[model samples]
Target: MASNSYCESCSEEGKPIAAIRFCSDCEERLCKEKNRNDNINESEKLESAVYEEVKNWKNHIIKQINTVVEKLEIDLSNCKKKNLDQVRKDNAKISELYDSVKEKEQELKFLKEHGSNNQLYLKLRKQRKGIKDVVKRVSEMTMSYKRTLLKFEKKAEIDLNSMGSIFEVKEACDIQYKPVKLQQAQVQLVRVESLLTLKKVKTNQLNLSDRLCLSDIAVTADNTLCLCNYDYGVCEIYVYRTYLDDLTYSSTLHLPSEPYGISILTGTDKAVVTLPHKSYVQFINTEHLKLDKTIRVGEGWYGITTTGDYIVVSNTKEIRILKKMGEILGTLQ
Candidate 1:
């Protein structure tokens, strides 16, 4: 809490007095006075306005649904008209064929009873031909006729709660807070002096079997440096002691795939490294100077770092933030 010179509790004396130290009750009284900043007089008006807005939204959605329903009804009416017309035409053709058959039957009976051999033969043949034509017409009509079926396809559904959201508006300076300024001494808690410049101290190189492309390096708790190198299509890690003035080679790790980057997680020995073009990360047991185990995090791993409870990995395209147990948290492009 910041100090105040004016006494808030003793202001009834008609003169101002400097407050040396405030008690708990005085602080509480001041806080209660400050808490009275809320003006609840317009709450009923706000409630009415919000209720009107909700009603408007509901009406708008219902109107859209009704419009769609009306359109569907019109289409259904047109479909019924078309289907009835086709059915009526089919019925008319069948009735005409029936009437013609009845007339032919009478002609066949009259010719059989009164006609000579030539007339009987010609009439019978013509009647058979007409019957065959009628049969063909009926068969064709039945085969060519199609039955149409209509279905109510629900392509979407309305979720009223998911349509929008309601939230409290917190404008600027709505919350009372005391801004604390850090002292200059507190600012430098991690470092006594700042780094000004760099100077060459010592330089040495470790020879490997193939070409070296130093991808990433990390310092372990053992005061050693583990360098991840992509060595001529092979993954290799070279360990070296950094406490000595001269670089001392410690050991080399051979991997089946090429390595991308390395990061330390409480090391002098143990570390983590990502494999290039691989979907997993290998844990380096620097104590045993060997790979402990591997966890499948993501694909196209390029660079990686351990921050608090998360392991952030990055490729050329995007970054994958993951938990320690290979759970994918999120991604950034």
Candidate 2:
């Protein structure tokens, strides 16, 4: 085993070796063989076995992978179908809402185009006026008809009285019969109901010749009329005794610049009057017709009215509400 030289065929000690493997041509282990032989058949068998085992392993893995992929694909398809169905339902709901909105819009347009409450009120007012006019005309015609019937009845009564006074007289006889003298025809129309007939009185008996030029008359809840007169820079407030009925010119008290617009305080004898040039509303007592208080209004005051506690006045382009003592509370356009 420790020799430097060794046999080539058997690996003997102290011998020269010639061949390390069998020669291909001689089918023997040799370094100098000249013949050749093929060993491809044996290598092909080993390769075929290795390839078959690898093929079997690859087929098994492929079958398992295909099964997993099919399951995933089915899940994906179901998710897509659910999403599509949800989208379809949403679209249907949107379409229905759009149709409902369109219907409401059409109804509103029809009402705006053809029907207006203001126009309806105007039409109703016109119809009411027509009905009132017809009623008044019929009343007048009925009164005339009743008057005509009364006149006919009176003429018939006069004719009956004249017939009772008439008697046939002989035209020619030895003793002549006296002829009655014909009296003048007299007639009177007697009313069927004395109380229902209206009595006509002559208004000339009052002899009302003095012209009353009263403005800004303040009346109480009981219809007592009062006003101020501005003559020659003097102011005098007057109260009519007999309800200003073409017979009275008396007054209780008076105050200054002849206040312009007057309004009765609700449920009281107090009143508010606007002095436009002075830009103030003055509260006056209806019983005494004297100034009780004065309150400043806005600029360019023109008209006035009272709502119980507050006095309302129309300024230039707005309405102003104030307390009774002339404090500005609110303004409205």
Candidate 3:
């Protein structure tokens, strides 16, 4: 309704009464009402709506800041964790090596006192083998545990356009105007395009056991590959590492049954493997390359994969969706 128009009801009766307002809908005209000024009603509604939008804008900015802060915090924590984990592993290996060397020292001392030439020769050969093993482990750790320091980087130019402009309706017909929507801005992470050329940087043979079938493979956070080797009815998960572009074998996980499928759980130092013979999926800690507690799902599980939060496994007939806690979600045949 617009103000300052003449009242149509009074004009028809030879009374030229000034109209207080006119209703755009139905073209109704009305004169003054006692103690009533409805002229600013539309403006007040628009003002309230604008205030609401401002509040929403503030909330949106806060959410964006929180997201960035959380990411930085996570990065900082992961950096510290990786450094500490590496140092701890190095200390453990060095300690073991020292203990073995000390035992050999004692053996050499006794051999020098009373042992014959044959005993001393055999002892020296075993000591040489131990020395070589220690050297290889030290070399592998130095390469795999490369320090990743998290540093904060500030963005230079943020070319953010307006969310939208607040429009005022000049004419009565403009009251039917739809508010302009906020322009969506998307931030895309740089991804590798097609035509990816992958050449084998290093390829060294594994001294595999008899009847070993290389079932599945998974790469760990420390840049080591755990290869599942099915030997006869038994299984051995070989943890292999390549240090300085030279391949070296780390350790082995001797499983009770023939392991088939394997996948590293996202954002963790653990891997979930499917052992069909045991009829369950087992969790393996990739950090130490050892078995963690597992979800004992009964069946001959074949393929396995994880979706950040849930674990998915498949067998001969059906596919089972499960949580890490062994909660079965659904089964599709």
Candidate 4:
């Protein structure tokens, strides 16, 4: 026979009723009426707390969106003002050029009409030369201004008229709670395969008239290889073009200091070469194969590599991080 349990709270109130459920935490049996009231209070408190959290979350997201919109609006206004100023300046230049051209035309007309005088022949020659010079100057100026206008047209133009697209708000879906389903199933194992096939390719032996001791090598995306040759007399970097089965020498760039480690900057026709026992790194424009800029990064920099907009240099005891412009950001010892 099953035993019937009486409610502890009801028993204390001098009215013992049958308990429907048992609470492990409370170590007591609860009747239906008392359990219903406790559940209702807990649910209300939970709903209130969740509502407050969601409200705060929505406010934070709205504030961030508003900040972004304000920043974009300010940028747009500044860009519009600058564009208008540039247009005004360009118009003024055009007007000045037009006036000068008109003046030159008048002078030429007057000189042609008064060319019959022998005493005025020398003055006519001088005025004709002046007119020729002015015409040439005006033509050059017009071409330059046209190029400037073309560049402006090619640049990005922001439209601030359709601000409703940026500021429009929408209602979000309500939060939901759902029970997750779990299932027992057998696991399957599959064999892995290799994607790469290694084979012997082409190799070239460099035969230059000048004796060279190769220090470091860097290759571009297009298979163009740059080799740093540390010679006793002159330090030079040789660029080579690699084909399917052969390599050919393209050009050479001479460096003042001894070139040590070299790395090609991705997506650009530039390479950063490190000079050992020196305080500067050379930025070579590989398009022309000449030194473009030199950035002083301190002494004892050997290995060099590019990471985004910054360069990493390694030495014996420390590693230095620097901007492309040569400013040292930090050092790890």
Better of 1 and 4 by lDDT: 4
What is the RMSD, in Å, between candidate 3 and the native fold over all Cα?
Answer: 29.4
Q: TM-score for every candidate vs. truth?
A: 0.46, 0.33, 0.41, 0.42
Candidates sorted on TM-score, descending: 1, 4, 3, 2
Q: Clashes per prediction?
A: 7, 9, 0, 0
TM-score of 3: 0.41
lDDT of 3 at 279: 62
Off by over 4 Å in 2: 1-214, 228-234, 243-247
Better of 2 and 3 by TM-score: 3
* Segments in model 3 whose C-alpha atoms lie over 4 Å from true places: 1-197
Give per-residue CA lDDT, model 4, range 1-333, as digits (tens): 022366778888987787666554455666787788786997799778777876787788779879977987787777778777887888887798778778866765776687656635765676687678777877887676633221223325755344232232355422122221110111122335767888877657888746778888998878888998776666788899988787999988888787888988888888999887567899988777778888988777888899778899898898999988878899999
Per-residue lDDT for 1-333 in model 2, tens only? 222122234444433554323322323332322111123554577578767876776677678768867977787777678767766766675576556556655655665679797765665565566557655755664464321111112234323222122233445321212222210111122324447667654342322224333556666776666664434344445666444345355554555565556789998878777665575667777776567877766445757778868888885688877777777798899
RMSD of each: 12.8, 62.4, 29.4, 23.7
Residue 289 lDDT in model 1? 80
- Where model 4 places Cα greater than 4 Å from the true spot, the runs are 1-190, 195-197
**Mind giving the per-residue lDDT tens digits that candidate 1 earns over 32-141?**
33233223435567778888998898899889989989999999899889889988988898899889988998887898899888898998887787889989998998
For model 1, give the RMSD to the true fold. 12.8
lDDT of 3 by residue, 1-333 (tens): 222255667677767776544444435455664113345675688799999998899789779979988998998898889888878977898798788878879999999889998999898987897889878877887787655566778787644465567786676331121112210111122334688687877667788787789888888767888888765676788888856787688888887778888998889998999888786788988887778988988968989989888999998899999999999999999
Pairs that clash in candidate 4: none
Worst 10 residues of 3 by lDDT: 177-186
